[model samples]
Target chain A: MLYIDSISKGIVIDHIRAGAGFSIFKYLDLDKADFTVALIINAPSKKLGKKDLIKIENKIDLDLAMLGFIDPNITVNIIEGEKIVEKINLSLPRRVEGIIECKNPRCVTSMERNIVHKFVLMDEKDGVYKCEYCDQIYSWEG
Target chain B: MLQGKHLIDPEDFSIEELGSILELAEDMLNNQAKFKDVCNGQILGTLFYEPSTRTRFSFEAAMIRLGGRVIGFAEPGSSSVMKGESIPDTIRTVASYVDIIAMRHPKEGAPKYASYYSPIPIINAGDGGHQHPTQMLTDLFTIKEVKGKLSNLTIGLCGDLKFGRTVHSLIKAMSRYENVKFLLISPNELQIPEYIRTEILANKDIPFTEVERLEDVIDSLDILYMTRVQKERFFNEADYIRLKDSYILDKEKLKLAKDDLSILHPFPRVNEISYEIDEDPRACYFDQLKYGMYVRMALIAKLLGVA
Candidate 1:
């Protein structure tokens, strides 16, 4: 069990895979921010044997759409006055831009400078997205 | 409607559309020197999120041969992608400058997403192992050019059927024709994926049979489409060593095939096809590459509305 001192208001990202919490933290640039953020790794969870949580002190614009690519099972909860205000279940975006890299070596994006890699959601249930140019499928891992 | 359409799958094109493209391809093949300036003022934007030298070269050569300008990168490292730019923004920005777009990525449906955000037409060069429609067109054109007919033929697909996107796309495309049977040859581990067999073959009631040895059915094949079985695809070196030579096509195997049986390969071949067999009149892979270029020229011309 792990707990963080209460903050005025912010959000809590739960159910992150153990050891992956730091990746999410770095990906969202959590440490560089001025907000009081708590990252607890290897916490107890019934669903997952081990999990991680990130509690932020300040409420910022969080791109919930990206959580699906990071970890689909993650749950985001907004905290207001130390109370849960809103729970936003991160659903996979129909199209993911610049989140996941295209693994095809011959893609123009691989050679070009300053291009955004894009993928369209083909099967939401399967967490499958197709590359716009190549039609390759990428699945999100939980 | 095809002007801005997304080609995510080979079956996305109807028979009429395929015929139109094929007819255009034939014209391009017949009068190669006459159609050089068809796309002089146009631009083709290639957004490859994945690396494919064969496909990239095919599209680039096709556009350049048509007098169209080509732009874009072969990889993501040199681009704003290294700076974390979004795919939609990239697509929209590129679409603003180009007349048409061809993209290749490792994600399955990336092209479909780009199509949604793109103002120009999006051609899926390849998306992972999911789809490669142009290759299908190339295969179709090759079959038509060599075998002289797409229907009423026994096409033997040998080697890595499970992950061979070319075989899958070819089967899906050829299944639409009349009276075609498939001889699917592969090791147990490399058999055709069940989803393909259930959804494309059995569901459509197309006649197909699975076998381990190509020797059993080589004599009856009108077309033998061979794909490489990479050493990495096998679980162990022993299995790779055991089964590697099983699917190889040399002069010995050629003896079992018909005199007119056309041999096709998607190239960059390893030991799956012996070099000694290249001189045989039946070897049509090189001719297939030339036909591929012609068909792609036709496809580009037709899709660009110049043909």
Candidate 2:
């Protein structure tokens, strides 16, 4: 029974995995924003037992697909004039760059400092991203 | 269809393309004189950023045997690379003089990166623990030539499976065939990575088992692929010493294996296989070494569209 005011013009990133809201907040650099942003953690939901939500009172260019890649269970709500305008569903991103790193130490990106780390989705069901240069499988968690 | 193709990974080609290369390799092996001057007056540029005697010699021999001349540097110090030239610049310049470029670089994916810029076909000789498609081609050639077929065999891959690039590529290539079972023998610290186990084996529904000892599974193998526990791959000297001698294939261990079990190693083997085992007829490493040259011959000519 937690309540927060809905935004008239903004985006609400919903259905974030419980305890992952702060990471998404920091990942998006929300702290540097001039507009009001609220990160709600451990919110009860029907789809997920507990989830995290981020309400931003500004229309910013967010890559919802990338957010989906970070956690596929995520949903994004675009609001205008206190009404839901659009809902974006996220899925595994086919290509990602600079957001994550290849864990393989022998990867070419590990050796060449100037190279950009890029990965392409190899398996959607498994959420596998392989390094573009060295073909090393990249995982977010060790 | 292989002409002007850059071999970055074994999976880069379809099974039919690989079969074509294998077919050409057999043709060249049986009738060397018939295709002796296939690449006559053509040139092969070998750009070795890392020091490699066996791989460099094999490519050079393959080109020379096909009546092609060799040009290029063995090490970076001798080339313009010493001037801090980028890989793209060097490959672009080298492509102008040679029909195809075979490069071994210290940085992984360097050849793949170079292939993006070079006009000629780029053969990756060895890229830092990354895909060495040519070596895998040589390995497949060895297995197919000796075993009389490539399908329906139990392959035991032993030692340093984690860091052995040859083993990684070979596993990916062999998993394409039917009825291929993998007995992945390695210490707990050197087990095959989860990506490989899950992606290559589990995804393909290829049967495989992980074990610590070679002796426990040697008798059941149709082919035993041995790899060195390289000191360079170890994080510390203590772990290197502790696991280095764990699986030496002496005569005692060989007795436990099948008589027809073909022993293959991507050489300069460092004490993994005992020198005494060199006398055994099943010891195919030396002949396998010869097959490396033939396979490279087939690969080079096919890439150049000369064969």
Candidate 3:
């Protein structure tokens, strides 16, 4: 295991579902962020069996609700001055706008340019979202 | 309250709203002349991205019968969609010209998407095997007219359950009623999707059963909803060929049904129901066309706030 220094101040997104760390990275646009970021994939966990962890070394504002929609198992810990300040437990977002694209070809957003794909979280425990326009269900499961 | 409402799915209307539409339909059935000119000045814009004679003609006839005018393309080739115009732009442009829109696209949720940008009420004519709310409304109207009530009925949905949008919508719509048991009839290869079975039916505690042969439960069904197994829905032609003739409702099959069993099909059917059975008194499929027109008229008038 490679060791990395603990962040002095920033957000640590932990307990992501196994194999979902890359999606969270892309979903949060962490690739383009101007901050020190450490992505630990396939970390062993007693609860999840295997998981991904993301440590961001900056006080960044983010939609943790949307993150919960991506992976409900995810937990976020905000650290300030190398001490835990806030911890966000993940739960399904009631509604999400523009974070994900509607893949259904018949979805209006697919043909209409520049229209934000708005989704309403229908089943929170299942993390199922339904398109506001066409009622197409999108779950977090592939 | 249904006036100026966008109906994207069968559930978009509350049970009360559905009742209101059904009530209006009943009134129209009793006194057709009273609603003949209900929408005299209103205009309906029909935006069909795919080819559809039955749906397009139904909407146009309904609007015309209500003294409302319709202006739209029968297909995308004539519209700005051929020029690569986005659906939002087309809907935005059409909203400026019409009081309401009846849109049909090959995509599953096109109308729902358009509803976001449209200022006027948007009726989903059919969206890419996703929804056909008006058709479901018409079906309910037909069922009530024939059977005298929407509840306490066993409806058997046969053929292509996986790709049949009408079956899916009707199932969802009827699930709202009391004692609506479903006898899902189809080949194992063409069985209803699991989500519909588990989420829509089982989750709601609606009693249902799956069967491969229609003849097995024909005597028990109050309504026999037949659908064509479309060639387009299958990936492998061999699979389509094998399943295409699985359930042909011939005169012999009709012998198994009840005397008052109402048979319906959302048409352009290919070989699902034999022509010999069309003369049977129980075949209410043809009547569905007329009821479809009247129900659509009620829907349009209600959506436009005329009724």
Give one digit per residue, the lDDT tens place, for model 1 in B1-307.
3455667688888988898888888888888788999999999988887677788888899899999999988998867777867778888899899988888876555676567688778888876555678889999988988878889999999998866778878999999999999999999888886557865788689999999998999999999999987664454798777776768898988998899999999876988999999999999999887777777777778777887
Assign candidate 3 its CAPRI class.
medium
Model 3: fnat (fraction of native contacts): 0.69
Give a tens-digit lDDT track for model 3, residues B1-307: 9877899888888999999998888788778899888898989999988878888999999899899899999889997899998888899999999999999888777787788788899999988766788889989999998999999999999999988889989999999999999999999988886557867998799999999998899999999999999886666999999899998999998998899999999988999999999999999999898888888888988888888
The per-residue C-alpha lDDT of model 2 at residue B254 equals 93
DockQ of 3: 0.53
DockQ of model 1 vs. true complex: 0.09
Predicted complexes: DockQ each: 0.09, 0.48, 0.53
The numbered model that scores best in DockQ is 3
Candidate 3 RMSD to the real structure = 3.0
- Pairs in clash, predicted candidate 2: none
Fraction of true contacts reproduced, model 1? Answer: 0.16
Tell me the tens digit of each residue's lDDT in model 2 across B1-307: 9899999877888989999999999898899998889999999999998888889999999999999999999989998888878777788899999999999987777888888898889998888766678889989999998998999999999998987878888999999999999999999999886768887899789999999999899999999999989787677999999999888899999999998999999987989999999999989998888888989999999999987
lDDT of 3 by residue, A1-142 (tens): 6788899999999999878899888878899989899999998899988889999999887787778777777889999999999998887788889877777665567766677888887676776777776666788662
Worst 10 residues of 1 chain A by lDDT: A104-113
* TM-score of candidate 2 to 2 decimals: 0.89
Q: Total clashes, candidate 1?
A: 49
